[model samples]
Target: MLQSPVEFFRTLPKKVCPECGEHIQEQAESYLFECERCLANKEE
Candidate 1:
């Protein structure tokens, strides 16, 4: 059986940060940063 959006998001895999070794949550948006600190540091 297929899972719902809520279930999918709940079971989403997090990505690791290469710079500071942080786990980033899966976001619905396409253009996302690996970590908040990285994004704030202009890693985009």
Candidate 2:
């Protein structure tokens, strides 16, 4: 069976930041999964 890209993504669970438990808004292609705030903090 084949699934459309949109359908495949919709079936996946939402991503959350491991550090803060905040919902992640990054795209699926993002190499890092952390949310923006956590990523910024880690870079400091």
Q: What is the TM-score of each candidate against the true structure?
A: 0.46, 0.62
Instruction: Output the worst ten-in-a-row residue range by lDDT, candidate 1.
Output: 25-34
Best by lDDT: 2
Worst 10 residues of 2 by lDDT: 25-34
Instruction: List model 2 lDDT by residue over 22-43, tens digit each.
Output: 8887664686778888878889
In terms of TM-score, the best-performing candidate is: 2
lDDT of each: 0.75, 0.83
Runs of candidate 1 exceeding 4 Å displacement: 1-13, 31-33
RMSD to the native, candidate 1?
A: 3.6
Cα miss at 7, model 1 (Å)?
A: 11
**Candidate 1 lDDT, 13-41, residue by residue in tens:** 77787778898765666555558888788
Off by over 4 Å in 2: 1-6
